[model samples]
Target: MKPGLMMALSALMATSPAFAYEIGDSISPEVAEKLNLQPGKAAVVDFFASWCASCAKEIPEIHQFIEDDKSEKVQVLGVGVDEDLAEGKAWQKQLNITFPVYDDTDQQVVESFAPIGMPALYYIIDNKVVGKRIGAVNHIDKQIRADLKELGVEQ
Candidate 1:
């Protein structure tokens, strides 16, 4: 291969989006263990960073969904993908987030999922991904409710 061609290919590969998990893809055991997934229960795993404004905005709405959740058939989990642990914790504190949030300072969790955008939400059941929402979403709480219903998760 020509040097210029190789360089061009390299650049293209570097800029390309990483492989993100899709519906029917199973979450790796390592990732599931990191998230502490509960068996026989569905999961809504959200990836966020302290610097992402959309994440900051959507978290509260997700919390609202959690508050209104009555069936207890699904678990909501958050992955704080901030490189600075203190900043992430402080943000969560400011948001008054009550759900379990994993501090992803090392970025393992987020990298594994490889969402195309920030503020990503993944719905999982039995370790397999069932649904996903990426980027800023309006009325995120309502969106989640509808998504869960479509996935056959009881509220």
Candidate 2:
């Protein structure tokens, strides 16, 4: 973000009703149910928008990870942050994204995971977010494998 935008966002967050989300908080139940989110398992929850270029690049990599892993112990869930549902859906179709997406048209889930930039991946295990990676994905597969291995998750 530009300095100006960063300052503006900072101001907004400072004035927001609650503090920004931190690691280890529970993923909301509504979101979990909507996406069939896998808790009590190794999971990567990617928050994205259809308009985000980073997300566009990163999502397919995650799908490929799912395909390459071929394990039930790990999961990747996409959370759409775009306000326009149709556009978000279209982007998903355009990319032929295979993983399930939970739409955050109201920004509730996204806001809860605040300080979020585009294409953010929240790494979770046993339902708690343990780590995060934010940017275009290049080594997602390797990272996931390493994280799961470190977490002692069978994947």
Q: lDDT per prediction? A: 0.90, 0.76
Q: Write the per-residue lDDT of candidate 2 for residues 1-155, one digit (tens) a residue.
A: 79999999999978674744467776667645665766566778888887788778776677778888877887888888889999988988999988778888988777777844777888776656778877766777777777777768766
lDDT tens readout by residue for model 1, 79-121:
9998989988999999988899989898877877888898999
Per-model TM-score, in order, reads 0.87, 0.80
* Alpha-carbon RMSD, each predicted model: 2.9, 6.2
Q: Which stretches of candidate 1 lie over 4 Å from their true place?
A: 1-19
Best by TM-score: 1
Q: Which ten residues in a row have the lowest lDDT in candidate 1?
A: 12-21
